[model samples]
Target chain A: MHIQATGNVYRAKAVTGIKTVTDILMFGAGGHAAAVSDVIRDIEDFNISGVIDDSPSLQGKCLFGSTVIGGRQQLYMNGLDTMAIFLGIGDNLTRARIARSLGGREFPVLVHPTAHIGTNVSLGEGTVVMPRAIIENGARVGAHCIINNGAVVGHGSVVGDYSHVSGNAVLAGGVNLGERCLIGIGGCVLPNVAIGQDSIVSAGSVANRSAPERHYIMSPGSRIFRRFEK
Target chain B: MHIQATGNVYRAKAVTGIKTVTDILMFGAGGHAAAVSDVIRDIEDFNISGVIDDSPSLQGKCLFGSTVIGGRQQLYMNGLDTMAIFLGIGDNLTRARIARSLGGREFPVLVHPTAHIGTNVSLGEGTVVMPRAIIENGARVGAHCIINNGAVVGHGSVVGDYSHVSGNAVLAGGVNLGERCLIGIGGCVLPNVAIGQDSIVSAGSVANRSAPERHYIMSPGSRIFRRFEK
Candidate 1:
């Protein structure tokens, strides 16, 4: 498979027939992993070989038709050179930690066929754009990030590494999210707002202003007494 | 076209190339109609013949290249047998009234190509599932409903007739919405919650419990002292 980098986006070109399917080792076998597995099954070119989960109980169990092989140590068994990995962990920090531990290994960016990714969108390695997620024009999604079901990353928005934009969340045009940020379900970040690293905009909360690092922009009612006004 | 009924769901089977393009008359010339029109254009088998609106200002005006002809009387002029109708009105009550007046007239269910519909999903006539909307497994959407942009109908949820699930709204698994209900933008109805008839869930509000009939569950701040508490 030949990958051509245009601007910041990497577009993969298939070598017809020979590269019909690529084996992918899934990291994490939780609920998010199940969802990601559904998307991987829908996508024609990718195949899940096995799941890698830390939980001992899940080690021999099957998740979405794929067996949980072992923990992070299983990566060595598959050989990173031949096996591509998909980060299935939902938490931003844990996903980032696992990605960093892999050294410089690049994971394939998985986008569901139903997702409407507009022109000039840049998706980093190991980023999984879920079903019906819209990453609009000029939006940049960082590595190991999860743009979950029906989420909309509006035009010119920048989602930093290891961030998770939950289902039905909307980051309006030109919005910037720093690393490890969590834009919760049904959350709406207004245009041009910047959310600092490790901050979390809770579900259904509308962020009209910038939030500092490690802040929690909870629901509107809770925001009244909170230190951060916006 | 042979429409096979399996339980509550109707699956329409295509009859080769003979019935490729379907002539559809849109019954609203408003902004919501324009959004629906965009989806109609994207669909391969459907074609918008014209628009029908009661307002004189909108009449003869073009909406997405389709001109507004007249009022409900225009349906007779166009011959309803030849052209299918789509209700593009945004208001739940207004859309319900319009659908009732057009008794026995079935409308085509429009699903945007980018929208992800899971297995065994049942969508009713005149229902419009907009771009990036996710209708998960076993979910049932009623007639003339609007599942707007980036909205999600979670697994096994039931949305009543003439209802509107607004943009970025999330109706979690097994939730039930009564007839003519409006789940507003960024609103979320938690799992198994039931919203009564003609109820309005205001934008960004989270409904953790059931709402009674003719109620309005406003945003978080407004939910503090409401008469009809969910």
Candidate 2:
């Protein structure tokens, strides 16, 4: 109400929704971490407050001006609900472990604009779907999941929470993922197969049949080879 | 005139376009065959008239009602323009061999609807992008390429024709792909590396260094490997 200030024009601040200023904790320090950080940066409402990693070399390093903190050796991020934690880990097994350590905390699910998620699809809280991750019609995803970059959750699939479908993994129609399951990088699960929870399907494997709760290591030939060569 | 006589429906033949078919001999018949067959079946334009394979077990099987004619020691579709050949091989090195054998024929490029191709992205004829494949902004994809399921071509990346980026492979920004290159399953190429044409990066490899060609391979830990271990 100051009449003398009429000649001076001030650039107006853009009005935003009431729920602004979301804080986020990123879970990795590698290239994938850097990439996810960029994605979180693109979102207007969220700000990456910090990163959690076990790498001593990166513990004090500045990642886009955020300090890297340590967590449970496996669960490298403190699951404090005051801020949402994102699983920047690309590996499924590690992601599942981290998700469990964060036990029952509210994880904010982030779906990138470029992604195409269809109707009748249920995505759990705290899951992050990168650009081009297509969740087709009739898909059910559980809580605390990580749908990595370019992954495909085909029609009529069920993925439990605390699971990580690695970057580029393809789960064909009607594939059932038990809780905390790990579908490794580029793994292909054919239609109608059920993977038990807490199980790890090795990277590059082609799963056409149901498997129990354990590590199903695949050889270079995409076959069920001997157990993982430690 | 026929509506009353034909059970309340006109029986006139539905007018349809006769798509220009690519005369081709299909090679490989497995999971990749299932996907390629699905595409071929969906696109009535290309008549995938027959299939050829060296596998004794699959030699006589029918793929999507199309019979497997014979082994493809040599290209043979009997000069039918309605058929254009496509390689249904999953792995990269195997496809390279198949590509060499079918040098004279034309392969039509197939792009799935779920793919998000960005601006200034140039894709050559005969390249196929499976579902959820993302060819980002400023990417130039060359001829005879196979950008498999859920693969990512980052912005400003240049992939030469005849190169195959296997399912879920990730190429970072400004990367250069040489001609006839084969990037294996789940491989990740770091930013700004120029991979020489005709080279093969092994599956699960993460290439941080530039790969000079003739022939070269790399593993995930950035160790030197081979394209095909005999």
Candidate 3:
């Protein structure tokens, strides 16, 4: 029997002698892709078929036992129904755009078995809940988000679409993150706080108050500024 | 068969027919208690008898399907030998004081089943390692401590008695935290850093330097101050 979760529901498929493992194609060739490959290997349910990267230099290179087969256009050439797709990009905006490009394609939610998700927690399509991450009761993690290793989504917290809650970052109770936000490594959002769309709370920073759209909230007393704006 | 783990030891008790489940009493009636209740429910080997809180306002209130029984005096009035106790208080100081008040009482360590405790890690009596928490190789966590949800005690770290390592906090390799310290939410203690007794590193703060006793360290450029002092 092979158990696979699609969307938020799990279904067990009966197979004869050996289990039928699914083929999963990784959609990036960077450091984040390497980490996701490790997690996919650890899961043992899927075989990494190949890696897809737009960078010309990465083509034909190997990562996590799979070769970089081709560029982003190859995803369209190959049948999308033949294998599962996992978003391996860490940047929220890039990931969101790639996800939009692959519109309506099957991107199963990949939750590492070690992750502890509490009652009534909803993980959206293509979201990856990594090792030792905790999504507490009533939390809703949006589509294509990465709830990274050892991260915590406190009770009733809302993580918006394509947001990346990095390793050991915390979203305390009732905190709301807008689309494409990056809660960096070991960062924390206090209870009931709201961070707007495209905001980046830098590594090791504390977000105690509400932040506006497109702002970068760095170290304490440092000015919050819009990215790419002088 | 009933298997119970104490410290680093697991003992199995043979029982005829149905397995014996231990009754556990929660020591606090707060948000943390609700979280711990969910973990206890997930474990299945333990049953929550009720919650004990000293607050007069919350004495009869129900939380997570369990009613708050009475004051601290009820603990002694009821037979302590019958059930195990789990500290659900989030504050290190209050938990320490309550543990001391319940002198000589048995407080079994509660580790969430999903928590990853690596080789040779030692968790002391009354310590609660919450869901998805990681105690890496050779780490030692002392008695009556809270290793909150998704917190990571890195390789060879030593967490002292009555300390509270909050959700998603990271104690990097070889870090040492003294008794009654609070490593706040998403706080990161750099490799080999030592925090003295009764100290607190606020949420999302990085502790790169050794902190003295009874001080609160918040943001960069902020002077550490004693709790009672202005």
Could you give the C-alpha RMSD of every candidate to the true structure, in order shown? 8.7, 16.5, 8.7
Per residue, candidate 3 scores C-alpha lDDT tens digits across A1-230 of 11222222221221112334488789998888888887776667778899988889989999889999888778777464546678899988899998998886667667776677766567777788787777876688888899998788987789999999999789887899999989888778888889888888887777877877777777655577789956
In what order do the candidates fall by lDDT, top score first?
A: 3, 1, 2
Clashing pairs in 1: none
DockQ of each: 0.18, 0.06, 0.23
| Candidate 3: tens digits of C-alpha lDDT, residues B53-141 | 88899888876677888877787764744466788887888888888877666676667776777777777777877886778888988
**Per-model B-chain TM-score:** 0.86, 0.71, 0.84
> For residues A1-230, what per-residue lDDT tens digits would candidate 1 score against the true structure?
21222332222221112234478888887556766776776675677888888888888897667888888777776264557778888778888998888865548777776677777777777788877777888898887889988789999999998999988889999999999999877888999999999999987788999999999987643211111222
Say which docking band candidate 3 falls in.
Answer: acceptable
| TM-score on alpha carbons, each prediction | 0.65, 0.50, 0.72
TM-score, cand. 3: 0.72
Give the CAPRI class of candidate 2. Answer: incorrect
Question: Candidate 3 regions off by >4 Å?
Answer: A1-21, A49-83, A220-230, B1-21, B38-44, B51-82, B97-105, B113-124, B131-142, B149-161, B168-179, B186-197, B206-213, B221-230
Q: In angstroms, how far off is A66's CA in candidate 3?
A: 4.7
Highest TM-score against the true fold, candidate: 3
- Candidate 2, Cα interface RMSD: 9.3
* Candidate 1 residue-wise lDDT, B58-90, digit = tens: 888888888888888878763665567889899
Each model's lDDT comes to: 0.76, 0.65, 0.77
